[model samples]
Target: MTSKKSITRRLTLLFVTASSVVLLALGFVIASSVGKHFEEQDMEVLTGKMALAGHTLEQLKSQNDLERITHLLDNSLVGHHGLEVLILRPNHEVIFATPNANFPIELVSVSAAQNSRRPITWTQGEQTFRGIAAELPTGISERSRVIVAVALDIAHHQAFMRSFLQTLWIFVAGAAALTGFLGWAAARRGLAPLRALREQAQVVTAQQLSHRLSVESAPVELAELAHSLNEMLARLEEAFHRLSDFSSDIAHELRTPVSNLMTQTQVALSRQRSADDYRSILESNSEEFEHMARMISDMLLLAKAENGLVVPTREAVDLAAEVLALFDYYDAVTEEKRLNLALEGNAEVSADRLMLRRALGNLLSNAVRHSAANTTVYVRISASLDAVSICMENTGDGIAQEYLERVFDRFFRVDPSRQRSSEGTGLGLAITKSIVLAHGGTISVESIDGTTTFTIILPRAP
Candidate 1:
């Protein structure tokens, strides 16, 4: 089994561990420093008392007064607990010592005198007691003067410091726990946005492409990411819509021809007939089928091109030559229809030859289909520094303003009832727009009065 990792838990653990380390170091320092100060104070008091006791013993008027001196000493030290005193000569012989039993009589500290005149100091039994030793200030009131010494117990001061440190450590540990808990809470609060982001991503799928993270409520750091995801979802939704519309368009466009073809095929095969009659019927039906197939193929091609599946093979081409060639091809038909095939100046542009041909061809077909018979359909190609435009204007029943924008939509028609019944795929304008867009160009239609013009603008040759 594995444990789940939590950010809050990690932050708390780290904070607590660091706090504990700092508190432990502080405790050690405080204990050492405070204990030293108290011990020094206790030693100073003991040293002073020792001197005073020696002076008192030496001030006695006669050697015969030893018993009186002892009694006075006992009375003086009665309330002074933990005090032990000893007096010694240069011969290391004891002259007097404190009667207090709570402290050892002479062995509390082994330190020698600080000088011939000052006391030495020591701490006893793991610093539980403070001790001082000194030469008894026994004066040579005579050469045989007696010495007095004292020891004071100091365990109480060290004990107080220890108790204080123990209580302080408990407080620090409690504060550490509280701070650790708070750190966990703060981490959780700060990371809430990330948690929400994760949950939202988990619930999202292609089915919910419309769903997007809310940038307004998200943290500033996540704002750009939320916006980018929303944009991607929007593009996907549009692509899906285009695919759906394209599928429906294909189904509607193929219905009538497929039904008619099936009927014609079955009927033509059902009965015996003369070979000429069979040939004529087969030929005509074959041409109709070919026309339907061509329309379907063109529609499919336009769909693929719009979707960017078919990339144009771009190249430099002589625009005027391509127009002239097309002019010759359509000139006979235009003449028979009494339309004018006009030529403009030569222009150069960078584009895909095949795609441009299709664009121009679609424009010519539109002109032929809509223009009045025996009237002039004018063609013009113009150029500037950065761009070139090919325009075709046909004299005809000009399109209504409302239908101008709708012309580029697949399967749409000016007449509502003929939308699905027209020979044209209704996608020629749509395909022209797609190809123009793919080539990094623009196309537009303008119609007023009896004039309808289609314009194609392409980038100029570099």
Candidate 2:
């Protein structure tokens, strides 16, 4: 696997590369411009000297005037150091030449033939010169035009340019290093908020899930990520709290039944009871065991549902029919309590038959158990375009406002003082919620004016 570079290092490298490219480009332009300037200055001096030589040759009337022309040319060269001039006839015979300044024969021949004024550079031994050549007319009609070449030594300029280039590259290297350091520092400072967020997250454990990352202090680009992380932490904290509560509730629920069984057995064993008395105690103990078995089964079902393992078998289930069936099943209890079962409206939903029946049964049982005598337990079904709603409302002491959200939580009860040995396991509402969710539905509750309402919404049949 390829190792990834840190943001700081990547940014620094990019900065260095960009700066180096720009600096090198500027340096190249500068070097080229400076070299051209030196060539231009040298060409100016060489051209001027050639012009003077041409003027002297133009004054030549005959062979007699040649000596005076050469003398005048030699005198004109005076204090012009590092300058050389060569004049040649059409026969390639030298008319005048600088002593010991032997310009190359090839350069003279090529420049004379081309008659170009553009400067050319050539090196001789330890010296470099820029020179130009032109054809000039003589005063004598019998003689042909003369070729005049002029050169200027540019060794000092070359030396200066070489040093300048060396200094420029060194400066660019140093600048790139400095820019890289500054870029790394800037990148590190820019990412400081992420480090802080990570540090805050690192301290978060199951026990410390309540810790939240600050979104306000984060950079705009990372603000959304921080907000999402905070939301996740909030969910984790709530889940952890629920898990803690579930652990305590399960232990408490199981302890009572086990303690009852143990106490009953101990009392029965201590005193030799008759066969009927022993049988009665065993029968009573069986009830507690059955209750425990039901609670454990409900918890297992809830666990399966939570893990998305409860795949409901899809079928069309009638809401009114299920409620009527549950009412008949609980007829004795409802009749004994003198409570009325009033169901209105009818809707159909596509759901698992047994699961749907179980959910409705749990809600109806709760409604019956909690309803005040002579008050009606209402089951209302309503249908919309895409969904069906079934509401179970009971006339009883309503649940508190704070507990509405947690009512469907496992083992949660409106009355904490309610005995664990109550007829139904506390997991009924939780199981109902899980079943409804398994069928891709939602369950909600609201209490108002001494009436408690539990609503289940499922997708309507296609």
Candidate 3:
């Protein structure tokens, strides 16, 4: 496979190629125009010279005046270098010729009538020539016809054009090279912002996720990139903080039970004890073990839920039946707290039966634990065309505004001191949330006017 090229090199090559093509095209056009211009100029000169020679022939009074005509031709041809003149008689014998003139005989043979001219081009050795031939009327006799030829050398003009084209090619190549260099330089300069972004990104780590790209200072084209990178950094930073907090909370929660078990075991083994005492110590240790086991189980369940490993079997679950079952389970605790439990309204939701039951049990348990004495804990279910909603409200000292949002977070509690009278692991609400989410539902909590309400909404069965 071939390696990819950089944008700078690509742009530079593009610029050079385009410039070279344009320059070559322009050169061809100019060269053709110049060649045509020279041909036209030479043709005009040759035509005039032919006309002059014909007029001189017409002015001759008789055939005996040929000498005067020759003299006139020689005088007219003076000071005109590279110009050749020749006069032929009716029998094609040269009658007059300029000194050193070597006009082609073929030019005289291809003759035109009097007052008419024909132009022709021929080359001799290294010299190219353009000329015109015309038949002239000699006044000496009716049978005396004179053919006049006038030619101009074009070798110098052809040489000039060759030199011009060579120079033009050299200039075009130089301009293309210079343009390529400039294009590369401009591309590099324009990409400074991207380079800066890369450098900034290189410095970022898990510990330094707070650093953000300066979007406002970036070029308009790169501003969106910078903003998106900054937003990603913000999310990574929040996730990092959450990970750190999760680690700390897990350590704290586990340490309590483990430490308690260790201290109690050490106390029991401090001296010889009766079988009842040993059994009682073992039972106490068993409670702490159970608590730690519950915490670990809840953590595993949450992890599986979050990773989409928990696939719930959907079924029609009656909300009232689930609430009644939970009330039965928590009857002893509610009776001790003198809290009354009430279930109102009925709805069926599309959910996993076991998962829904567990979620409602957790919510009811939490409400009963927090409700004031003799206060009623209410479970209200409602249904719409497409969804079912369950609201669990309990009368108590409501949660603080700040803690309401995080009440469903794992191990979070409104009580900052974490003091608990019940055998709760602080994962009840968190488990409820995970179960609800696994069933394609949402759970939210709000506390107002000495009342805390937990709401769960699930899609209705089709």
Candidate 4:
């Protein structure tokens, strides 16, 4: 909660402080210098008049005339001078004043005697004056009859400074506003290219992977950013292209082997042979063909998911039933691996039924293949109205912490030897992750010591 006045006040403080300091400093120096200069000049003129008056009195002593001194004094007070001259007798009698008006006589008498140093006093007219009094060196009056008073007016210099301050205020305010506006406008204009880049980035989709940031007509700094972004997009496009080609290549590689195995299995079943001979070949060939089919399908799905072609068809599904069904489907594999399978209580969720089933089947198969003999693998489902979570826990050699998150990446294998599971094809977890995400779910795996768990959480239907 800040007001505009506070903001404006803060901004003005620096200039205002500087201006006040400068103006006050100048005013002090000017007033001091002008007063000193005026005093010196006036003192010289007053001392000269005193000398002339003393000479006039000395000359008047030769003639012994009072009219001569009176006439000389009367003519001296004729014009409007910057300095006013007043003569007072020892009895405080006003003898003569230059441009005679009732200027306070005691002010002159008391101020001069009390403090001979220059006294700067202000009068009722709001004007500055300096006052001084000295005894005239005249020999005509023996009783020290005259106090020579000089008052210098200082209003013009004061008025000049006040007018300067008014003009300075206008200049400072106008400059601050003009500079602030120019700064704000320049900032907005300079950031225009970045705003354009953001708007263009909003429409970039996977299908339009070739789209790049525009560099033309951009500032040098923003142009560099544009070039870097374009390079990143090019790399991403290349990676996607290679992935698409690899998916096709994998399908071609597995389809021939699978087709031959399927054909041989069918031919053996069709011919008349002993049940055990046909059964052995049929089982061996069927397993090989089935493995090939599973690998091919997972690879295809991984490709489709990367291209964002798979959208989840969400519906309310009974998780307990789906687990039981997958258990039946892989019952032969589980028995062959010497592993026990178990399912937990019923859990209902909103998810893609087929995708969830495939993801579950992959997790179960991986768990079964990795687990030791006599160990149990559990498929558990927990649910509420808002969300459902499925966890498959198994007793297997757990993965390292570093490779846990990366296990869901396509074709990534933790085994440096690449010999632990050749039939895996490395796309199981990848496809599972893609499917879960399509249903607005998250999948993660955690392993500790010798237990690994793959957990999936999805939105549950009301």
Clashes of each: 5, 0, 0, 0
Q: Cα deviation in Å at residue 233, candidate 2? A: 2.7
Candidate 1, residue 382: lDDT = 88
Residue runs of model 3 more than 4 Å from their true location after superposition: 1-4, 43-125, 128-152, 269-278, 303-321, 324-340, 348-354, 373-375, 385-387, 416-423, 434-442, 458-462
For model 4, residues 341-406, the per-residue Cα lDDT tens digits are 988877778777898898998898788877888889998888777888899999976889999978
lDDT of 2 by residue, 1-462 (tens): 999878888888998999899999999999999988988888778878988888888888887787567688889999998888888776778888888566776678788788878887888898988888878888876455887888888889989999999999999999989998998898889889989989988989987888888889888999999999989889888778867877788898899889999999999999788999999999999999999999999988987897789998887878788888888999999999999999999987888889899999998888888889999999999999999989999998788899999888887888888776764789999999999888888999999877999999988753
Best by TM-score: 2
RMSD of each: 7.5, 4.0, 5.3, 13.6
Tens-digit lDDT track for model 3 on 63-92?
Answer: 678767878887888788988888887577
**Candidate 1 C-alpha lDDT tens digits along 318-412:** 88788777778787777777777666667878888988887888888778767788787777888988999888899986889999998889877
Pairs in clash, predicted candidate 3: none
Point out the higher-scoring one by TM-score: 3 or 4.
3
The order by descending TM-score is: 2, 3, 1, 4
Model 1 lowest lDDT segment of ten? 108-117
RMSD of 3: 5.3
User: Model 4, residue 284: displacement in angstroms?
Assistant: 9.3
> Using alpha carbons, what is the TM-score of model 4?
0.43
